[model samples]
Every structure is written in C-alpha cells, then in structure tokens.
Target chain A: MAQRPTKETKQSSAREERPPVVREKAPALAPQRGRPTLILVGADKGGVGKTTIARVLLDYLAANNVLTRAFDTETPRGTLYRFHPDQTSVVDLTSTSDQMKIIDTLATAQVRVSVVDVRAGGLEPALQALQDTGFLDAVAEGEVGFILFHVLGSSIASLDEIAEVAPYVDDADYFLVKNHVNDTTFFEWDPVTHRKYFEKVETAGEITIPKLNELSYEQVEIAGAPFSTFVANRTAEGGPADHSFVLRGYVRTWQNRIADEFDRIRLLDRIAGREGA
Target chain B: MSRRTLVFVACSPHPRSGVSTTARLLTDFYLSRLADVEGFDTDPHAPRYHELFPDRTQVIDIAAIRGQISLFDRLLVDDGVPKIVDVWQRSYDRFFKTVKEIGFVEEAHLRGVEPIVLFHVDPSETALASAQSLSASWRDLPMVVVQNEGAAPLGAYAHETLGHYPSTRRFVIGPLDGAVAKTLEQPDVSLSRLLVAPPPEMSIVIRAALKAWIAPIFTQFHSFELRRRLEGAQFLK
Candidate 1:
C-alpha cells in the first residue's frame, strides 16, 4: 500500500528485524569458536546399533549445550526420531532434495551440530552423495567440522567398510565404533586385519560399546525412551513410570562409559572447532 | 498392603556350605506360612532345589538370554509370590555377574520385590572373602549371614567390619540329627508340613526334636524378613 517495497529492501529490513545469534555459553573447556558440525553414523549392515550410537551422540551434544539436530535415515518410521522426536526428522539421505535439505542448511541452521543416522546399506551411498555435493571439500577447507562414525558389526564385511569409508575421512574425524548392543562377538576379525585398517589411519579412533544386560536393553526398547530418559525412569512424555531403579542405574552407568569414549575423542572440542585446545 | 515378593538368593563361593539347605527351608517356611512362593534352582544340570518341590519350583539356567528373561522378567512382575533361589557356588560368579549387570536388585526394589542374599558362612577363606566382596559390590542389597551349625564358626571373619556386613543379621541353620535330617532330606520333603502334621508313624520324640531343631532357624528367618520389611517398606510409615 505505502509505495511498493523492493525485494532487496524487504529482505534487508527482515534481516534487520532478527536478533543476533546468541551463542550458548559453552563450558570452560569447550572451544572458543562455535562453528557448525556434521556427524554421520552409518553401518553397511543392519542391526549394528547405529541408531543407538547416534541417539547417544545427540544426548552427549545436548548435555554439553551444543545445540544439535538429527536426521534419521530410517525413512518413513525413523527409529532415531522415535527416541528424540523433538529434535529429529526422517529423511532419505540419497535423495537430491533431501540431501540439499541436510547439506544446504548446515551453514545457516541454528543448531551447532547436525547428526545423520545412516540407514543400513546406505553408508557408501551417503558418502558418495556428500562427495558429489562437494560437502567433503567444504569440510576439508575448514569451513565446518565433520565426523564419520562407522558403526561396526561382528562380520568380516564390517572390516571391509573400514577400507571403503577410511578414504573419505582424511579431512574429517573418523571413529570406528564396535557396537555391542546385540552382544556380537568379533571372532572373525584377527589382529592382522584389524591392524591393517585401523592402525594405518593415525587419526582413526576405536570405541567399544560394552554389552548391556539383555533384560535391561529389552526394557528400554519397550519403554521407547531415550537412554537418558530411560535412566531417569521416565516415559517419553516425561510422565511417571515404574521402571526398575537397577535397570535405570545400569543404563546410566553404561551411558557414562559411552560418554567417556566420546570425551576421550574430544568430540565436543572437534564440533566446537577446537582441535588442539 | 502391597504384596512384596521376597527373592532370597542362598549363595556361597564354597560348595556344600548349606546353600540349598537354606533355600529349601526358606521356601518351605513361606509355604508353611501359607504365603505364595516360587523356587528356582539356578543350576539346571543339577537342580536339586527343584527336586524337593518339583511342581512349584523351576530349574533356571540364566547363562543363556532366554533363561535370564524367563527368570528376571518374572521377578519384576507383581506376582505376590516370594522367590527363593538355590544358587550353586560353581555358577555363583556368573549368576551374580548377570544380576548386577541387569540391575536386578534395584529393579526388584521398585517392583516391591525384596532380594536378600543369604551368604552361607563356612570355614574356607574363599567363602569368607566372597561374602565381604559380594556385600561390597551389592551395597544396597539386603544381606544375611547364615551360620550352618554343621560348619566352622567364622571367628574373626564374622566381625562387623570384616567378614559380615553392618546391616546383616546372623542365622544358625543346622546341626541336624542323623535320623531326623535323613527324613527331611528325602525328595519333596517340607519341614513346615512335617512340623504342622508329622507322619503318624513318626515317633513323638523325633517329631518334637525336628520341630525344636527348626525353631531358632525359622525364628531368625521371620525376624530377618520382618526387620527388612520395616527397613525397605515403601508404604508403611
């Protein structure tokens, strides 16, 4: 009505209206720079507790006030979304638009960390997608921080993944996670083969997710709550639940163990763009 | 009153320290009191506990996941039935390891299940050490020191700061007479049933002696359970 405003003027006026990004007060040990972080949790095989690892990472990031968002690759019915419904979305990582939705927003998203839970058999495809989009190039250029968590199962194929995925993580943080959520035994992996893939990469880190009790694990699944929530003995909606104290303690202690590994890797520091600090 | 399930785990690292005897008597005592009770002999291979109460007791080998679910899943359920486990020393480490891993005792407390460890105090240094070690690991777990009248006295090991824990009370189980003990040792035998109505053929003197033998033990069991109920009682102020 009042002299038709130009697009540029309106955009500038709108940008002026928005408040400045108030960076969350990181802990004294956290890095000074608060750059965006991208973490990929993937496994070539199904049921390696990839989603479980991603959920814990989200919790760890959240605990450190990292301001994290997650994309569960378990499309249609995201297992990660179920536990962390408020901060997650289900997406097809290989789809063009979906890829853009994830990769495009990292530069501008309010969240400091973005976690992508790669679906079964999607690790290579997801990596290739990142390569095609030159996302790895951006990460290498130090525009943003990136991490690839290769969730390993018990099979020989899991070892083969180290060879396939190891090449791409040269510019990003690479973690080889041996998920024992299913209590898998790696009798197939001899020390020589283990050394060939793991030892060769000086930057690569190994994390062993210890075996939790069968009943406790099953109960948590049945409760359909995040590990932290389960440990608190609360329902998904934060309602009262009659969960066992012993079971909750088991989860809490186990989560602490897993969190210790993340801490040892300086995960928060890497996400905050502090390599040596 | 919320029907609390008492899960008494009669255990020892040393063998034949009267673990099964304690378990059997406790199970029998619950049955005698007309309380709903279930028994589990952790060793399926040699399920001697279940042999006494075949219909009521189950042989559960918790080494496998399936067995663990069968036992632990039910323990958390509000069945209003107390459970007594005749734990084998051979499988003691594995059994407790799994229990501690699963957080069974804590869970049991939430579900109104009281899990008490009845450590069979015997002569071996290993047994004494394990009693101290186990009580330390399971600090929140209710413990009772069982002194088998047939076994050696714990001496310094029974001291509060050393072998025996602070909260635990002492129980003297047996120095049973040969003929009387033989009668109770028979398969499917229940001391409670015998005490209530001894067999017609059983001599009055033998019956009286059997009742007398079990008197202090049963009193200790009742008193220990009452004290625990008073301690861990969620409802009663």
Candidate 2:
C-alpha cells in the first residue's frame, strides 16, 4: 500500500512536468493568403453528410495550407473546433446584422474563398429568404460559389429533389458527391441516371466522392486533460501522415480525391483564364 | 446604418436578468428623448449607442471594438455635449489591483466626459435572491433602492447599507399606467414598463449628496495615482 502511494505521486508529478505536444502548423494557402472572408457550407438535403463533408474539406484544406473561415447558422453545432487549433479554420459567431458586416469585410478581398454550409432540406427556403433580403446579390459580387449535393448511389429521386432548387445557383458550380457508400450491391451509378441528373442541373461540376470501399479510418486517441487535442500519432516526429498501412491508405484515398477535384477546378480556371469563374 | 456617437463605458454581456432589462430600457428611454431615433434589439455586436434617431444603426461587436476604436472615439468627439449612458458597474475586485472609488470619477473628469451612470437595483424577491449569489464586488457597489406601485419593501434592509453613499440615487418606479400593482403581482417576471427617468425629488437631492460622499475619496485617489507613478523613483531611504 505504501509503495502504491509513492508510485501514484511519482506518476502525477511526471504528468505535471511533461511538456505540451504541439500540433504541426500547416502553411497558409496561396489562394486565401491576404483576403480573409467567411465561408458558408450548405446543402439542401438532410442526412446528406453536409456537416461531415464540410469537416473533411476544412481539415484537408488546412492540412494542405488553405486559410478558411466557417459559419454555422444553428446553435452549439459548429464545425471550426472539430480539429484542435489549426491555422486553416475560423468561425464567426454573429447575428443577422453582424453577418452583413462580415460580408462587407469580405468585399475588398483580393482573394476571398467562402463556403456556405447549409442543412439538408434547408437550402430552398434559406436561399429564397436571403435573395428576398438582398443578401445573395451582395455576396455574389466577390465569391466563387459552389452548391454541394450529397446523394446515395442509384438515388435519382433524391437527385431530382436537389435539381428542383438548382436554378437559384444556375451560374454557380454544382457538385454531386456520392457519400457514405459502404455497399455497392443495390446502388450503382448508371450512365443513364448520371446523364439525367446532368440534364437537370444547368452545369455540373466534377463528380468526386468515392464509395465506402474507398474510405479509410485510423485509430487515433485524444490526450490532454480535456481530451481535446486528438493527435494522429501516425506521422514521423513532425512529418506528413506516414507511409504506414492505414495512414497512407487513408491519405492516398481521401486527400488524393480532394486534390483531384482541386486539379479539375484548376484546369477549368486555366481554360477560362478566370480565378473564380 | 448611419453611425452615431455612443458615449458609454464598456462592460461584460448581460447576465440572465436585471442587467439586460436595465440596459435595454435605459437605452430605449435615452433614445426616445431624442428625435428621429431607431432602436436595435439587445445585440452583443452593437456599439455603445446605435443611431436610434439616425439614418441607420449597426450592432458593434467586440471584434469591431478591437478593429476600430478610433472610429468610436471620433464619433464621441463629434457628438458635441453628448450624453454618455454608462452601464459598467463597480467591478472593483476584478482588477489586478484594488480600485479606489474616486479613481473612477477622476478618470472620467480627466477624459473630459461624465457618463449618466445607471445603477440598477430591483426590489422584487427575485432581484434580492439574485443578490444573495452575487460576487462580493457587485454587493459592494453603490445601490439605489427603487419601489414601484404595490412593490415589495426592497429598501427595508438595504437603506442602512445604501444610506452610507450620499450619492446614491433612488426612484419610485411605476408601470406605464403609473401603477406598481402589475410589478407587485409578477415578482419574477421582468417589468419593462419601469423607466429609468429620475424622480423630481431625487433629482433635487443628487448633486449635494454626491459632493459629500465623494469628498474624502478624491484625496485617496490622488495619492494612489501619485504612488503608482513614483513606484520606480528613488526617494530618501
């Protein structure tokens, strides 16, 4: 019993003296270097992985050195604090009046990148209200807008629902991503259905997200007293995620997919000679 | 919104009860006194005083304060003979060093500004119950005992403590109908009809009371400032 008490004290002291482990800071992205603007991530459908996709894109962008700010319209359900203090994430907690001020701040942007994250089935009404209030016209002046539609494989009906609200953002890039696909049995992306969905949208961005068979996860644990600093201890002393089995597979699959989308958009940018077009 | 000069001290966000109501009504009444005023809701982003009578109004958030305090100062100076509605109460203990009471008044004088301070004191059982859990600093600040029609005897135990501050201002608040009966019936429910307008009798008493109460503290404040500036100076040992 006496020995146990001494061991406990020793452990406690060691824990107290241990230096804090700092997360690797990614460099700021060239695309969002000078101009800090608000990004709203929105989708018009429910259970469409809007929040999850936003989190993944934010993490990937931050890891690759993209400076971004996020906003959530709802309460206690924010996405900025998902990964501990990284350079790529910013969030604005503002009311309706203040949101306008934030938009005004973005107006002078030399390079402003904003994403609107909307709840599934919440896009139609929200867009109409914003348009009625003259907020969207103000926003469209200096923003590269994208409407994300996450659908299950072979769900043309779901895609059809999204298409009904597609006219509002006819000029914006509309991306149809197939999300959380763990099984390929019942749902397959038919060329016929793909063409139909394309016909519905004025212009379709690239189809990017892969099936669940392509997705990967790592067994990472959060340390620190608050259990908030969830470090992926899969990398070298301070390097990119390692070439080890799970980490490499996860990065290669997800990161490469996002990079491919970026490349596709980059090609389009070069062809049009327009950064935001 | 057209920006207007907001002459007020800064304080934390509203607590659950009296603080919000007091701040809101005080601002509303002050704005109502002016012509062509528009009022914004209680917003965390709003500046000290939005242009209630203005061409436009915008809530000034803390970020705005950090970004452009100069703009705010300019507005203050431009609104000549501006009425400063101060809401920051005596948070004496929160400071790294203890604040002498007269230090505050002298700072205002040096700054060439005098804010119309609103010291909110509610007589309801609900308000008293809140005080029981209040911080020591909050309990120590000067308090005014207010009674509306049919209101509870809030001043019964408070008068002895408040009587010490001759500068303390009290009011017999009433509903819009000039009846305290509504306030008495709903002790827990906040009474928005209670305005911050000073009672005529209290107005007559304030100046003399303030002079007597603050006289001794003025010297203490001066001494404190002197000691602060001379801390590093070499003196006769």
Q: What C-alpha lDDT values do all the predictions have?
A: 0.78, 0.38
- Model 2 TM-score on a 0 to 1 scale: 0.37
Tens-digit lDDT string for candidate 2 (B144-195): 3333322233356656643533334444333232233232233332112222
- Write down the DockQ of candidate 2: 0.00
Evaluated on the second chain alone, the candidates' TM-scores are: 0.88, 0.37
What candidate 1 gets wrong by more than 4 Å, as runs, is: A1-33, A43-49, A59-67, A74-86, A131-134, A153-160, A181-189, A212-256, A274-277, B1-6, B54-56, B74-82, B109-113, B151-168, B225-237
Candidate 1 residue-wise lDDT, A4-76, digit = tens: 2343443354245644323243222123245678999998988898998998888788778878889999888
Estimate, for each residue in A169-212, the C-alpha lDDT of model 2 and write its tens digit.
54344455556444422134466666655554454454455432
lDDT of 2 at A207: 48
- Model 2, which residues run further than 4 Å from truth? A1-40, A84-95, A108-111, A139-157, A184-194, A212-215, A218-245, A267-277, B1-237
B1-237 in candidate 1: lDDT tens per residue? Answer: 444777888898878788888888888788789878888888888888889888888888867766665677776776768888888887799788878776777778787877878888766667767877877887888778888766445556446433434344778876877887787777855687887887787778888888898888888889877776686567776
